[model samples]
Structure formats: structure tokens, C-alpha cells
Target: MTHRYLKNVVSLELDKDKCTGCGKCTEVCPHNVFIIENGLAEIIDRDRCMECGACANNCPFEAVTVEPGVGCAAAIIKGWLTGSEPSCDCSGGDSSSCC
Candidate 1:
């Protein structure tokens, strides 16, 4: 099955101008989030990203950026278990806190 988290919530950003078509993001991404096409890196599946920061770290041209460890995965799993909307409530002293 294709794993997808909250739609349009991932922080992944790609600067196509800086990509240079190196294909490093495609190689390092665990979720196949990137694809090199026409000499530019593209974010093929942003929701599949687990916020692991691998693509950003491996991009030699500094084309990719993402806020890793933003509790997206945890929030999605929590939502699945509770049948609620995915949310990352990092505030302390709360039952719904995913941090």
C-alpha cells in the first residue's frame, strides 16, 4: 500500500532552480518523494514524506528543505487509532499532545 500522511501538511520545499538534476534527493528519500525530470528535482509525493530530513541533507545544491520531527507521523498514527483528524499538539499538559 502507498503510505500517505495528512494531505498538504508536509513542510518539504524544493527550489527547482537550484536542483541541478543531481538526483541525490531521489536516492536519499525513503518514501520516493522526489524525482529528477527535465534536469530538475520535483516533489512527486509530498505527503509520503516522513519528515526524516534525508532529502534536504543529501541535496548538494541546497534545493530541498523540510522541517523534520514536526510530529506529522505521530499525529497521523494517533489520528488512525482515535479516528480523528491528524494534529500535532505539542503543547504540554494536554491529553492530545503528540510530542
Candidate 2:
């Protein structure tokens, strides 16, 4: 699947030392951001991540760390201008509170 991306703002840190190569991340990622090879889960496409928190939530070994937020400059600017909280609509507005 081809996942669209605006920017790579999601803070994803993969600790290979903690990964068990379970491929669980691959299964839960909607954007195909993770790939398992040589008994390890590698971040093949960090930019494609939508910060949905699925990979981190599903990982049993807690190998994946994701901050789960958006990088929308327009939303941020709008929030500042409107004096409201910035939120990302991707995946769901509730996932990323970018104000």
C-alpha cells in the first residue's frame, strides 16, 4: 500500500536490542513503515508513519517508541491565529494534539 505523508515528524525510535523480530509492528502499521529482517524490525520508511500509535501499542517487546503527533504547519498556524489547540486530522484528530 502507498501511504501519503506530509513530513517525518513522528518521533519513532527503534531499539533493536529490545526487538524480538516478532513482526508485530509490520502487522499493525497502516503505512507499512516497519519491516522485519534478520530477526529485527527495521524502520524502512519513517516518513510514511502517520503517528497513529498502533505500532507502539501492539509491540509486545516495546521495541518501538513513537510520540504520535503531526507536523502540519498550517494547523499549527491556524491554532495560533485562532487561539485554539492544534490537532491533526490524520488517523483521527484525537491521536495528535499538536497545539
Candidate 2 is scored at a TM of 0.66
As a TM-score, model 1 comes out at 0.68
For all predicted structures, in order, the TM-scores are 0.68, 0.66
Alpha-carbon lDDT, every model? 0.79, 0.81
Q: Pairs clashing in candidate 2?
A: none
- Name the candidate that leads on TM-score: 1
- Model 1 global lDDT (CA atoms, 0 to 1): 0.79
* Top-scoring candidate (lDDT): 2
Compose the digit string of candidate 1's lDDT tens values, residues 2-39: 55567888888998778799898888898888888888
Colliding residue pairs in candidate 1 = none
